[model samples]
Target: DAGITQSPRHKVTETGTPVTLRCHQTENHRYMYWYRQDPGHGLRLIHYSYGVKDTDKGEVSDGYSVSRSKTEDFLLTLESATSSQTSVYFCAISESSRSGNTGELFFGEGSRLTVL
Candidate 1:
């Protein structure tokens, strides 16, 4: 397992508030990803970074932002958290996962956030 840590493992907040989730890794992998899990929709990507300061929005990026200032840290922020954003957020690290090259996604324990 990779050395990954997520802060504030559990949180409760009201609607229209802001929230930030931090992901730290010691594996020094080049790629890091943020995803949210919900019932029906399963797991959806919020954002990902390939390198320091190089990030791209994912399919479900609305109201969400991400930053990667260092190789081992990735930050995900919710500008204005809503009730619908309540879900378990996961931070994943991978060496590579494109084309013929196969890579495994190592996920953190997860951060559960609830909005009222």
Candidate 2:
């Protein structure tokens, strides 16, 4: 949703390999976030950026890196893939309201990554 598009919707990789999932948005929202969804963990934040090149680490940021060079692109990179990192990753875009982070996010379908 929100004019977001995730690339490599499904991927299977070996442990220790490197992988990158891309999220592109057409809405030009002011904020973008990376979240992972697991069976028991639900949705957890991985990283988020409020503006281009301005990013902050999230709760589950370890072993992952994100880059936002433009308002329309957000890239999530896994330096070394691991089995524990297997999950559905989502990209969300939102605009800050007068009250700040309205907590209303529009998410992309999701990118499923599995590490063997």
> What root-mean-square deviation over C-alphas does model 2 reach?
1.0
lDDT, candidate 1, 6-104, per-residue tens? 987999999999999999999989999999999999999999999999999999999999999999999999989999999999999998545732557
Reference-based lDDT, each prediction: 0.93, 0.95
Predicted model with the maximum lDDT: 2
> lDDT score of model 1?
0.93
Instruction: Estimate the TM-score for candidate 1.
Output: 0.93
Worst window of 10 by summed lDDT in candidate 1:
95-104
TM-score each candidate: 0.93, 0.96
Residue 84 miss distance in model 1 (angstroms): 0.6
